[model samples]
Target: MHKKFMYICFMSNSKLYKGSLTTIILKLLNENDKMYGYEITQKVKALTKGQLKITEGALYPALHKLEAEGLLSVEVKKVDNRLRKYYKITENGEKETTNKLDELAEYIKTMQALVNPKLA
Candidate 1:
């Protein structure tokens, strides 16, 4: 039963990602000057009260993809005797983030109307 529940949760999260993971990541970076990979995952989990978790398996790839697209800039810094890579939004990333946020808002509004239509 626990496995079943976990599977259901995975399915739902998978659907969420199908729509908004990239936009969500961009939004986070837009709010902050810079963030590291692990920091991003922990911040997201805390903000969502553990409802949403971005595993490293998924997150690193997304970060790499964003960096490749020139939407994110990467910097490596030495922290606690180890190198940590941080990501910051570029000028293009800021513009892209704004556009993506607008698109996501429209999507949410559409979903709300479909899920609970209001009588006019």
Candidate 2:
């Protein structure tokens, strides 16, 4: 029963995680100073212990949207004869990161209450 519950939670996580992608990216940039697209993907996987994977299809669009919103600034540099774009959280982004993280925390608390009221 415990293993089955764990499996179910992990499966649900994939769909739930998509909604928090923007916040996840912002939080990572806030901590790392700057990161490239692929680096961000790898970091999420590592941090989640291989449970979570961020695909390029989802990541690039979120990065573009955040850049467009002025929450992120990008710098392109040549590395190993290839151009790589690094994303850094802007001043606005730093502020937004705090807001988003707080919001996510509250959401998690609410979810806990709903899913397992005894835990709350």
User: Model 1 shows how many backbone clashes?
Assistant: 0
Choose the strongest candidate by lDDT: 2
Model 2: ten consecutive residues of lowest lDDT: 5-14
Give the candidate number with the greatest TM-score.
2
- TM-score, cand. 2 vs. native: 0.86
Worst 10 residues of 1 by lDDT: 4-13
Question: How many clashes in each candidate?
Answer: 0, 0
Clash count, predicted structure 2: 0
Over the stretch 1-120, how does candidate 2's per-residue lDDT look in tens digits? Answer: 356444322322446775788989999999999999989888988898888878777889999999999999999999999889999999999999999999999999999999999999
- Candidate 2 displacement at residue 25 in angstroms: 0.3
- Candidate 2, 19: how far from true, in Å? 1.0
C-alpha local distance difference test of each model: 0.84, 0.88
Superposed by TM-score, candidate 1 places the C-alpha of residue 111 at a distance from the truth, in angstroms, of 1.0
What's the distance in Å from true for residue 103, model 1? 1.1
TM-score of each: 0.84, 0.86
